[model samples]
Target: MGITIFEDSYRHKGLRRKLIEELRRKGIRDERVLNAFDKVPRHLFMDSSFVEFAYQDKAFPIAAGQTISQPYTVAFMTELLNIKPLDKVFEVGTGSGYQTAILSELGAKVYTIERQKDLFQSCQHLLKMLGYNPLYFFGDGYLGKPSYAPYDKIIVTAGAPEIPKDLIAQLAIGGRMVIPIGTSDLQVMTTLDRISPTQVDIHEHGNFVFVPMLKGTNNR
Candidate 1:
């Protein structure tokens, strides 16, 4: 019955502070984004053995060969999306659901997709336990969930060869998407703002490394 996993607040607090300092050094300026970073108990999103390092501004390995996105990466992407309270968000990789938790905390209605069955099950349970009602799905992120198409904000936690055209098509007229495109060895973190049904502006903002985004799952 590993039903309850409480975060070590005292330890996380110090690391959380360190994470914030790193964000400042890295030019993450949104205060709301910073709050999301501090409030989301990231330690709750990692394996117990590594909870000790959860807020270190570094990615920690989670199940299914996934790493919880770095704290600064979360903050940076959230800031880039400029998500409002009423925005509907779609997360391409649920992983440990830490980013999903932050999105929910920021008042965005989240629908997250995780391909690995085990990771999906693990993240879904933890999210439910935390009282976050982010809709969880086991499927290929390459094909954005059509049932929830027209998302106001979409974020991909894994690296893609290119922004999935289907995902862009799913974005609302004025919606935005943040994704890491290119290869793991060299990926560019870019934000796509849908200017219209037929036009979008791409803003490139440095780079990151992540596991490759794969296709398909057993949700059939």
Candidate 2:
């Protein structure tokens, strides 16, 4: 479903504030991430039926059989990347475009990819209408976007069976990538810091669940 509602009421702001406090209690300490959350109206990214619950720290179903990542999950992954202003960030999934907006709020030059055509189009439209300017791609994210290679940071929003090498190759030396790797049911959130062209530092953050990252685009 496309985002049809644009109004963010006082109640919505109040609810979002509560959600941010909840995230803080959950140990999300990055003030920048919190401020971004405070600015973006997440309800605008959600379908109308779920808009009322948009501020909750939970994931909800969107179109194309995909689920938006929970607010805490979004904050966690984003905070891990430690995005710098104007950092070129390559995002693996553009589902809902909520994360993309958050990245834009952080002043990242975002290059986001979505394998699902429906999501790619809808997210692109909504973000444009909302004033975000991320470069959007409708293709297999596994291949990454080589045209804009050597990104300062990479974030894969889905659970991948394994880290795609192409994405790693696209990362600039000293770049960091946050991806969830494991089976379909569970994934360990992992970070790869490319210290050099041939070397990386790997660390596991924790376990989280996400929709599986697919191989190719889905036109339907």
Candidate 3:
């Protein structure tokens, strides 16, 4: 893969710091999550046209029909996952690789899937250039990654019509899965904690908007 060069200057760092403060004021109390945001250069993950607003706590369009999730949403989901160092995290969408970098920054061994071939390839290159080493695959997010089962935490970054049973099955007992389930326009942020082999504790956070989680891979 060819290296994509982007500069991260002091101005960008200042902007990120401000963004973190904004997130904190918005009730995101996880220091680790904030720290991850502090480290990753959000502008570097965005297109040149959108880079100026990268730290604005909003979503921006990416290569696929997907958006790089808003900073608040990303922080909220990461906080929900309660990530720990070396924890195995299964991520459902690898859009722009921004969230993937955050997971890496929080010290998780991330295995992420993206169905859009263009996004999968570009994000893989960008993550590698940024020195993130997450295992990335181009496949269906609904199917999850069974070859590396029993993840410590699973995070789905797209809106799903229903909770994917296959993904739930891939969660380790005692593991947590954060997903957005509802219609295409809006979704309730829900978390499933697997307490036993067949029992899961469900909790719903607020609603958020995301691209629909589609089936199968876009090999083109």
Please provide, for model 3 over 160-199, each residue's C-alpha lDDT reduced to its tens digit, 9 standing for 90 to 100. 9999999999999999999999999999999999999999
Off by over 4 Å in 1: 1-4, 218-220
In order, what lDDT does every prediction score?
0.86, 0.95, 0.93
- Model 3, residue pairs in steric clash: none
Per-prediction CA RMSD (Å):
1.9, 1.7, 1.6
lDDT of 1 at 42: 83
TM-score of 3: 0.97
> What value of lDDT does candidate 3 attain over all alpha carbons?
0.93
Models 1 onward score TM values of 0.93, 0.97, 0.97
Model 1 residue 106 lDDT? 89
Cα-based lDDT at residue 89, candidate 2: 99
Model 2, 159-186: lDDT tens digits are: 9999899999999999999999999999
**What stretches of model 2 exceed 4 Å from their correct place?**
1-4
Candidate 2 global lDDT: 0.95
Give one digit per residue, the lDDT tens place, for model 1 in 20-97: 878989899988888888777788888889866776778888887678878888888888889899689999988889
